[model samples]
Target: MTESGVAAGFLTLVVVMGIGRFLYTPLLPLMLTEYGLRTEQAGFLASLNYVGYLAGAFAAGPLCHRFREFRVLVAGLLISCLTTAATGLSTDFVWVTAARLLAGIASALAFVAVSGLVLLIVARDGRENLTGLYYGGVGGGIVLTGLAALPTARIWGAGGTWILFGAVGATLSGVVLLLLQRHDEPRHSAATPRATLPWHPRFARLVIAYGLEGFGYIITGTFMVAAANATVGPTGAHLAWVVAGCAALPSAFLWSTAARRWGRLKPLVVAFFLQGAGIILPAALNGAAALFAGALLFGATFMGIVTLALSEGASYAPTARARIVGLMTGIYGIGQIVGPALAGYFSARTGTYHIAIFIASATVAAAGGLLIPDAFAHEQARERR
Candidate 1:
């Protein structure tokens, strides 16, 4: 892959997936404090975003085929920026809800578009390993969110912080547009055969495990900072978030390298189990130290899982890049939609996030368990074949 293509892909992820989608996590506490937003309402709003993301993932493949990745990616980024900014325009729950929903759709579009493009490019050059670097943008964006929110929330409140992130996202989007100006976006060729998903048992297993991962990880991703803030104050909470981001930034690259050395399936199984442990740590213990340790594990494993799963999926259907990606992402989105809503309902009633956290951890452990057969038995079977 060319340097510019890599840079553009990285920055696109930073703008959309990082700032547009995940900035909500660090800002959740602020919204709760500023607008008297209830936990259930927050969960609903988050689920709405994932709902839109599900819609967007389903749409991304068709849109890319119809409009090309460049146009779709650019449009998604712009819409993401606008929707993020719109959140600051009103304190009304309805308004913020709409904003978050729209942001989710835009984020999914941009995320899938760029991922397809980058994966296609790297596949041509045997640089599939660089996917780690490409996905690291999300962590980079999360770190920025954590850092910026501290002063911005203190100075102008949650509304101002939202507006500021919107502006920053827009600026970065413009940079991505420029950086990618020379890179050729892939065009679907009429001569190429239409791509279809293979009806393989391994792919089925992967989809189920990935869906479970989506259901399991999002609870911690959405609420870890808030849970920490409640336990250790705002400063410590943000610090924990930053720590997660720091671990996240290198995780994709490191995990990718490990997969290259150790083979993909075993490493993937390890990541899933490690992530399960990470998700439960803070809930099992208390204090800043526990939170930070959990944050490191959470950050380190989530993107690594993404890098491995998506790459593995791509290998399964090389001819249908967008379709396979959209399918996996669409399933993942469903899990995301369900996780927070249930977590919020239970937490709000019981007055602690402990129940939700424990369930999430167990769900992730189950996901890891689902992959063990593939990691061992199936791998040996495939090698024999």
Candidate 2:
């Protein structure tokens, strides 16, 4: 693959997966209105996507040992893209739920498999210099979803808008698929060994932190728009996501650039704390500006965690990296699976989303604390050989 080929393939893969993620909030209110859903009802359906994703996350590892990832990835993207488009065509909540569930599962398969592969591919050259180009998908999709939502907000309702975006994504996937040279992109590094099943103790701690982050980050991200709506009214919801998207555009660059200089663990710890503060701040202040800033912080660091985690796991015994990532991702998926449901439960009790956000902040703070001992001890343990 040419440099341009890598860029195109990586971005399309990320965007296809990211669409499953960013689609919800932009479409949530529309789903609620179109389906006449209760808050919990909507939430349950939304959480179902995570459930499917969790299942997919677990399967990616074993499959990695068996299949070529780019092939699997292309298949996953095609399925997800089709599902997203189909989800749009549905009129009822059940149909939408089914589509989202399938989309989530397919997207997860693509996400975990490609991510595991990308980590392997990038580590080969020692540069991974264009890493930001890969993550740019999140920011790009955020912008795409946000911008797409605006035009359809008045005309087509939620389902129609989802269909539109889904069509766009699916169509783009075909173009991207055609451009990719399947054999060229799959790089099994010479320095790397066959992926093993389990890892040392340090992997467990990192996995826990990732899970907590999944729980913590989504608690706020799930409800950030609602908070913005309550804070500055309707405009705030749009602005909040927009700010998150705008902030995200530069985040991969900023964090990845820093990781190059500062190394992964400490920079990641600081990033986690910053993210925690972001999740907590809007809850405390409960205003438009605060929510916007919080969204920005989240945008800046959210993907950074995954970047660090992927890179960190890659540095482990080469034979163990995929399984390590798979396990850690599964743990994180558990957190995502639980986070929104907990937030919904808390919101129902308190009649405000702030408490949930605060809880999320606490979770992130705790995750950060775990890294303190993890950072130093992990290195010392590695050196004991």
Best by TM-score: 1
Write one digit per residue (lDDT tens) for candidate 1, span 1-385: 3666777888888888878888888889989979779999999998999999999998998788777888889889999999998998789998999999999999999988888888887777777778899989989988988888878888988898889889999999989888777767777755655588866898888888889999999999898888887889988988898888889998999999988876667788999999999989998887777888889999999999988888888778897888788888999999999999988999899989999999999988898898888878865546624
In candidate 2, what residue range of length 10 has the lowest lDDT sum? Answer: 181-190
* Candidate 2 runs further than 4 Å off: 182-194, 376-385
**Over 4 Å off in model 1, which ranges?**
189-193, 378-385
lDDT of 1 at 170: 91
Q: What is the TM-score of each candidate against the true structure?
A: 0.96, 0.91
Question: What lDDT score belongs to each candidate, Candidate 1 first?
Answer: 0.87, 0.72
Which candidate's lDDT is highest? 1
Candidate 1: residue pairs that collide: none
